[model samples]
Target: MGMKYSDGFSKQLPTLATVGAALVSLYLMSQAMKSIPVGTAYSIWTGIGALGVATLGIFLFGDRASAPRLACIGLIVAGVIGL
Candidate 1:
C-alpha cells in the first residue's frame, strides 16, 4: 500500500514540478513585464519553458534522443536563445 502510493506520487512528480515552475515563472515574468511589453514577456516565458521541459524530459525520463527529437529540441533551444 505504501509502495503503491509512493509510486503514484513519483509518477506525478514531473508534471507537478512543471506546473509549479510555470506558475512561479509566470508571476515573476508578469512583474518584469509590467514596465515592458506583453509580446516580449510571452516570448521569453514560452521559450524558456519549452527549453526547460525538454531538458527535464531528457534528464529525468530517460527519454530518447532520436534524430527527430533532437531536431525539435534544437529548435526549442534556438528559440530560447534567440528570445
Candidate 2:
C-alpha cells in the first residue's frame, strides 16, 4: 500500500490490488474469527502472511536468505500451531 501511494500520480492498478488484498484479508479474518478466538485467528493470519511474503521475497525478489530468518519463520509457525 505504501508502495502504491508512493507513486506521485496514484497508480490505479497497484492501489486497486492493495485494496483488493486488504478486503479479502478482512473477509477471511472475519470468517476465521467465527470459529477461533480473535487473537488466535489474527496471529495465525499474520504469521502465515509474513512467512509467505518472506518466502516470496527470497524466491522471486532475491532477498537474502539467512539461517536466523528461517529460524524465525519456524518459530512463527510453531507459535501459530501452539495457539
lDDT of each: 0.71, 0.82
lDDT of 1: 0.71
Backbone clashes per model, in order? Answer: 0, 0
lDDT of 2 by residue, 1-83 (tens): 33435375388777777778889999999999999899999989998888888887888778888999989989988987898
Pairs with backbone N, CA or C atoms under 3 Å apart (clashes), candidate 1: none
Cα lDDT for residue 11, model 2? 84
Best by lDDT: 2
Distance from true location, Cα of 76 in model 1, Å? 1.7
Error of 2 at 30 (Å): 0.6
Candidate 1 on 21-71: residue-level lDDT in tens?
667877899897988688877887777766766677777777776889888
| RMSD each, Å | 5.7, 2.6
Candidate 2 overall lDDT versus native: 0.82
What TM-score does each of the candidates earn? Answer: 0.62, 0.82
